[model samples]
Target: MSTKTVRVLALVAFLASALVPAAGWAQQTLRIGELAGLTGGIAPYGVQIHNARLIAIDEINAKGGISVGGQKYKLDLVALDAGAPGEAVKVFERLLTVEKVTLILDGIYSSVEYALGPVLKSKKALLIWSGGNDPATTVGVPNAFRNHFDGGAPFMKVNELFLKKMGVKRVATYGQTGHADFKRFVEEYLPKIQGIEVVATEWHPFGEKDFFPVLTKLKGLKPDALIVHGFFTDGITMLKQAREIGLYPGPLWLNQYGAAPLMMDEASRAIWEGTYEILKSSWGVTTEAPERSRKFFQAYVKKFGERGFGAWAESGYDSVYILARAIEKAGVVDDPAKIGAAMQALNVPDVPELLMPYKPGKLFDKDRQAYPKIIVSQWKNGTFVPVFSDFGQ
Candidate 1:
């Protein structure tokens, strides 16, 4: 079976099996709507995220579901494909009105999340986003929570950690032209550091596969590093094209997923080696650097047979844990509004097996963002190995 089909079948099995435990309880299953892109250009990411999410749901079911107000309730994850922006809105509506989910995963895409703000407010359902790094989603919405960082903060942190300390003078970037966070990082944050100068910058429109022209432009400048701040798929194509044309950039900082060695062309894989990825967690990082991240990789490979990418999927796995924790803390599963409040108030001691590298002291900011250390990893020997640096909580 294809990886997507396997994941879907597993999801079906979990949804079917979850209800067995709730049979005796006062509460039915608590549904978390995963707003994903399962059939579009971004479908691969959804597959990785939802599959990771299934592992969490299965664990909960195995333990006889969750306890809220002294009653046990099962967890059910419903995957809603947000392909086209309009269709995504309709799917979000269906998840709220028809499926009546207690909460929805932030629609992975920001446009879907933007239109979803009113839906969340209208239905009073909770929304948790892990993959998107944009800050706008949680800025003013009480119902929204981020399992990841504000989009640009990690890049700024990267600048502070690597660029400033290394004393790199000139830098160039390949970023999404219209992306707010990328543009801001290149224009605003990169300039903030004392000695660095952003000499050459190139932009690519969304879904422009061939990056030869842009790479050609960047190669001439030969900056210290080619900081690529595009989406994941674009980064893959750009790196491959850059290498194929015999102008492979060095010390690339890819602001996207890097654990996609399974998907790359073999030659492209070699070219992508040593590229940097600002991520939250990694499998190799667990053993290599001995950081506090989920022991998720081994189990995930065992179950899914090695098609996963992006540590963001690990955040998706953590999302379920955080939401369930919030529900139990609220002592109620019926009201998402109460759960949202509980999520904000959650400062529980971190478990040993946490997927998100939540800070030693706290779990979330006032805006409901996790303060996980920005785990930066690189592609070494076809695996993303964490580059350890001391970061503050």
Candidate 2:
């Protein structure tokens, strides 16, 4: 062949080789299922979690995948949208039986977690999820593990501090009637605070947009603080309507969930300003936050163009790394029992890829639930800033 022809052929051969995996060193595929509410009422938070899962899987695969038994295995994520409990159960079964996904990253939605219990037990698959603050759902489950906030005592303590800081006396409660966790946070936990009396309580359906009538009733009750328990969209709608109807100036707003940056995205800064909240993660508010969190936030913004990326979605990202580390520790790629054991016994310091802060010793306690460090964050001038943290004290 002529020299020019040989040069062109060699260049084409180089490009083809680079496109294919190296012989004998090619990475194997390990499939992970991601269950989230990509549609319906919970879509706002679900999309964020899904995005984070994608980022984590991409980063891991880029770093030559997970090393197990001296072999490289890259993650293949299969995401499904199960916005409700009935749908979630079906999706959970599909992920196990059809998709054959033994490992899953479940986004926050406690009712769905409860519904998936029997299936998880039967399939013996590993489910690392967010939410399920109730100990009953998390404590004794064998295959189920939580990588999110503990809403029992730790969350209550932070809310108590928030109440004290706001000088809240009589509080009115409002939340979504559909979500068990959100309803319980407003009905069960808010009433438990010693000094504050739950003066008036009202609940709206999952997708209610107009809150004028309820706001009117709440305003007449004259509460010192109002507890809003819905997600960012509905939460913003309720607060904005409250301001329009002249109820906001009367009651100090206390968000039952974390103060998400998404709230500011949905509504203006002036709408949620001065709102007291129990922050799930101190990603932006604290200096001690994990370095990966800062990098992850930047990556998310670069990929998704920054609507309102919050730390709440970091659990999904952490779940991916947590499982990868477990696979490494177990020395096997496909065994669920060994992998689950490794995850349960995971030491936080060992997994530097984690974005959320975990309590010392292990990621999960005896209950198989990880307790995230709490921060009392409030909407200041234009951002959510930390006021108190349970980090050192």
Q: Which candidate is the best by TM-score?
A: 2
Please give, for residues 1-393, the per-residue lDDT of candidate 1 as tens digits.
899999999999999888675645666677778888777655666677787788889888889898987787889888877776677778888888888876787536555666666666666778887766666767777788887655657546755576555557788888766566667777888777677777887788778887888777777777776777655677778887877765664544555443455545566567668777764443433335344333466667778866544555677777888888888888987788888888888774733345655666657677776766666666788766666533332
Following a full C-alpha superposition, what root-mean-square deviation does model 2 have from the true structure?
5.5
Cα deviation of 387, candidate 1, in Å: 2.0
**Please, what are the lDDT tens digits per residue for candidate 2 over residues 235-258?**
777888988888876777777655
Best by lDDT: 2
lDDT of each: 0.69, 0.76
lDDT score at residue 86, model 1, on the 0-100 scale: 75
Instruction: Quote each prediction's TM-score.
Output: 0.85, 0.87
